[model samples]
Target: MKYIKLAAVVVAASISGCATILSEDVATVNVATSTGKKIDITIDGQNYTVPGVVKLEKDGQSKIISTNDADCASSTAMNRKVEGVFWVNLLSGGLFGSTTDSATDAMWTYDDYVTISCK
Candidate 1:
């Protein structure tokens, strides 16, 4: 019984980071245009149409949405913010959990929705 309990604790501790457990390397974000026009935008060198959801990697780096279309305006998405669960894990699960989240880059998150301006 003692060995079983110890093993369980070890497993829990190894996977305790809330952000690491809950978040993924990619997050889906809603992209839209102020003019409500459907246009192609480039993100991370990948072309995507606005007014849709795009899966972006949580790399802790800023992202800019650009387009060759003359009628649409480019937009910048700032650096990802620390996930709320990261803080909670830090306070409750301590440094081990928080560190795991940081190392995995699961602690980072971007805005749920972004809008690009257009003419």
Candidate 2:
């Protein structure tokens, strides 16, 4: 009976340990026109909007991709949840403008990898 109680306690501790951890990595890609116009971005068939005021460098440089830790519900036992917002830009004639009005949100599972692209 004592051994059974101890075994139960160990099982509970193991389960608790697995329930409170989360982690994720995020990547972003930027595409720009040769004339320094707007940038186009698409991820998983979704369009993202970037501000026109933010112009791509003259030499067409890609923005530095970043990763961050995501918060998750401890009681829900989520190993990882990727969540964030991003933007994309579009150019029209000699003027630049934002193709979309608001930032878009993205989410991923613990084992999922997110890729962003410009076309």
- Candidate 2 has its poorest 10 consecutive residues by lDDT at 94-103
Scored against the true structure, residue 74 in model 1 reaches a CA lDDT of 52
24-63 in candidate 2: lDDT tens per residue?
Answer: 1232323233343333433233444431222221111123
Each candidate structure's TM-score, on Cα atoms with residue i matched to residue i, is 0.86, 0.23
Name model 1 segments beyond 4 Å from true.
1-15
lDDT for each residue of candidate 1 in 70-113, tens digit (9 for 90 to 100):
77775656457888889988888568888888888889988889
State the local distance difference test value for candidate 1.
0.84
lDDT of 2 at 79: 32
Q: Which residue pairs overlap in candidate 1's backbone?
A: none
lDDT of candidate model 2 versus the reference: 0.27
* CA lDDT of each prediction against the hidden true structure: 0.84, 0.27
